[model samples]
Target: MSSSFRAPPIPSSDEIDLVALFQVIWKQKKLVLAATASAGLIAAIYAFLTPPQYEVSSVLRPAAINELDALNRSEIYTLPPGDALVRVGASLESYDTRLGFFRSNQKLFKAFEQPGRTLEQSFEEFNRNSIELILPDPKKANSLSAYIKLEMSYPKGVDGVAILNGFVDYAIATEREQIAADLDVIVKNRLNELKGKIDAARSNYEVDKEARIASLRETDSLRRAQLQDELKALRAQLKTGRIDRVAQLNEAIGIAKSLGIRKPSTPSALGESERNGSSSVMRTEINNQQIPLYFMGVEALEAERTVLMQRKSDDFTEGRIAQIAKELQLLQSNREIEVLNRRENEDLFLAGVQPVRAEEARLRNLSIDMSRLKLVTIDKQALEPLRPVKPQKALIILLGLILGGFVGAFIAVIRHLVKTRQSQPQSAALSMLSNSPTMVGSDTGLNKP
Candidate 1:
């Protein structure tokens, strides 16, 4: 048997209902109004009841009269300007350091202290939420345009301003103390190094002086000993009377020649004068006759002794030994002058070091009283906030109205979909019953069979 199939009917333009969506929303209007009203009421209550916060801020530019410049002007020591300023800014912005400062000066912040809260706990809370440090742009960090901005928030307007001013004061004082410490370390180390150099120079000079003296003494002793040995040898030669023999021979020859003798023989007797010891004149006899002879040995020996003494004197006056002594004296004098100059320089350096140390100590003591040193100037002071900065009441209420409308629309759509599903089944059953054929004729035919 063949089966026939029919397609489901498509709706006409007029039957395709667009107004059903409006009808569904209209039916749930009460629910939408209730949700929106509830959200708006909650937002209004929050805006009215919540406490408002106030902000206090100040701008700080690097001061024209910096600590480093001040130190340089004082002439005690010089410090690098750029590095010093950067370090100062960094120290001021450091969280731990700032917190420590606040904790140490609890009396300053005591007005803000909450009941039943310890100072440490209060400081922790304040640091976490209230304090903010805005640094300069990274690209422009080295430029003079770089600056530090400090901001603080508090529940009360006056408290905000007071805390910010106190923070600024503390930061400046701390920076000065740090700079003074750095200067002290630098000056002390330089002073110690200079002292060491001076001591080493002095020690070297002393060692050189002693060596020069010892060398000169040894040279003088050797030369003097040589001259004494030569003198002694000459004395011994004169004492031996070797010069007498030659003189006696010469006298004999002279006497023989006077007697017309071609050959002269040895003198048989020679008489020595008692007046002169070995150098006395003597008479010689020739051919058994007494002949007066003058022995020139004594005179020659005496003259030779005089020449030796003159040479000895000349050696002492103009020889290498004298030259060596003069040269050594000159050298010693020059060395002494050099030593004196060095000592004078050392003394000057010592004098300079003393004042620098004293200045460093004075500065260090002054650092304890930060009022004496102002490292930074607050360019703008924090003023009392005129209006509350928190809650944003109008914005909050507007956002609540918008969000509530969207939530109400979504709930209405869901309700419409559920109601439509519940009515669809009943309509399908009623249409099926009306479309089926009547059962009366069918029952009569079945009973005849």
Candidate 2:
């Protein structure tokens, strides 16, 4: 007896209460199937009938590293540049920007070419959901604020994605090309202006030189002419032989005759001889007066002319003109080159200091080629969602099931309480007895039990 021990009964799978489970399912089969099918159908419908989302991404490139560093050093960046890359960053991240991008008047016209809905209705739908816009981090550089990511959706079956993408691309490309071309034109015009200035400067230098030489020559000629006039006046004053002197001589002769100095017919010969002598004397006097005047005038004229000629000769000489012209000529010849260099130097100043202004165009082009981001590239590709993310069926089903089960359980509990109350009669009797406590007397009189 001490050695004997009974073996515990082994439970068989067949003996398990499968029937209970089957009964429970059969009793609630419609509920279970209905719940599950409703959930599944809703899920399928949401998946198939609901529109598929179209994700659109627009990229922006960060400002160049060197430019960013330079801007950082500048005092202006403390408040952020009006044209800074960061300024656009906020817009890129704003909900309004995204919303405006999708439902903006411009975009609306581009996409649908009409405003079918009222402003409120359009805004309502815009807010309700159909678009997602974001600015993703750049992939390569750290300090850049570069990319703009956008997504817009219409009901499934509409070509909204393709149409929207085409519009956006066209607009972006056109804007970028126009800006680039405009910048190129500005640079070319600036270069041409510099060239024109240089040409004008050269012309000024040459004209100024010629004017100076001409003035010097004219002054010299004027001096020479003045000296010649002085010489002409001096010669006119030196002329001899006067009619008054001859009249005085005849009067003296009549006086001598009245004094009775008798004369013969030879008086004519005498008079002739005397007249001849007078004429000779007059001629000698004239020679003496005019010779010195002519010689003196010639000498004075020579001196003045010599002085002026000396000065003029020195000033207008080919060698002298050549020497003076060399500087002007050199300046003129190099004017274009110098001006070009000066312009380049100015550009270099901007390129070195506010390179953003100069390189802004280059950066913009690069941005167009790449994107409008001024941020470092942290990631290149957009975040791809795992699923369509709309009409989450499992969640919907869970919610439904919980709600249904709770209702079912509440009804079941209430029913169980009602059944328990009906099965117990003591309560009603107890309640009645409580309400009226009375004594019952038997026929044998008051008897104690």
Candidate 3:
């Protein structure tokens, strides 16, 4: 019992007077209810007057594997299903493409056209606010192959479903046409490149042929010159030999005439003459180089000299000359050059010509029917929406009621404070009169010491 409990401390003045505030609000309950009702009525009227908005959406997915197989063939243009779907999505997302579609199909959006706004301006507004391109989240896997979503909003009367469907089809067609054009341009460029290579190869072949022909001509000319020179030398040697023979015969004929010889005599007759008139000498010398030219009679020597001098051509006697004449005749025309000149198709001879031509043919024949190619598969088609997306009357009314309750409570607090402030002066005067030391001419003369 000696342990004493500490007294509770006084509450701070900063604490809120929640009970007093609640009592004030209860006292002004009629005002609060009236404000809430008025706000709800105004909200209902505004909700009824606001225009309704309907939304139609369509989903685009990846094309089939077989549909993109042709485009991916040979790797000339690789377009996977995902890639094709992405391309179509990008085309759908293009503002210019949407505007172009709008311009082409203006009849579809006739309801959007009203007074005070041009058709183009209405279409611009529609393009900005109505059409929306929604892409899929990259973080999640889409089992349905949902590549993109196209959303369009319209008024109560406009047909947003039809507009969305038409635009989607138009975008796919435009993408396909672009693909075809790109393929065509690439094919043509490849063909031209192949053609240029072929032409360059042909030019190289011509240059090589000309070079070979020149080389052959040079070789043939050198050979002909050598043959001509050899032929000339042989003819000169033959002529000189004939002249030497004639000189030798003339000298022998003079020796025979001095020795009183007329007919051809053998060495034995000369030997006999030497044995009788002079010392005995053998018929044959140790190394008799040849029979002396004088051994033949002067008539024989002279006749031989006349025959050697009267020869017109050495070709008849010299076998080498006839051989040279045959070679010169053979070298008259180069067969190789003739063959090269007679070639009708020079491209055949050029290296790598056949392969180049084959490549060109392949490029030229590279084609596919684009009409059957599918760019995107419409997984979810746009449907006519029965419910309006905008003008949520219930939500608006609920928010209005909440706002009115707060406003009404605030007004009640202000009015209470003003009336309390006005009564403060009268309360002070009454306290002074009642608690004074004495009251003059009052009913009760009560005073405090």
lDDT of each: 0.63, 0.45, 0.84
Model 3 pairs in collision: none
lDDT of 3 by residue, 57-121 (tens): 99888888888888888457899888898899889888778888998998888887778997679
Each prediction's RMSD to truth:
10.2, 17.3, 6.6
lDDT string, candidate 2, 60-145, tens digits:
44435643443344322222332433434454444554445555444443333335776556555654565455554456576444
- Candidate 3, which segments miss by more than 4 Å at Cα? 1-30, 64-66, 80-86, 116-120, 136-146, 273-289, 404-449
Clashing residue pairs in all predictions, respectively, total 0, 24, 0
The estimated TM-scores of all candidates read 0.62, 0.41, 0.81
Worst 10 residues of 1 by lDDT: 264-273
**lDDT tens readout by residue for model 1, 266-379:** 233222322342453344554665534333333443454455444423334335545545554554345544454456444343333465555545645433332465455567
- Against the true structure, candidate 2 reaches a TM-score of 0.41
Please give the range of 10 consecutive residues that has the lowest summed lDDT in model 2. Answer: 283-292
What order do candidates take by TM-score, descending? 3, 1, 2
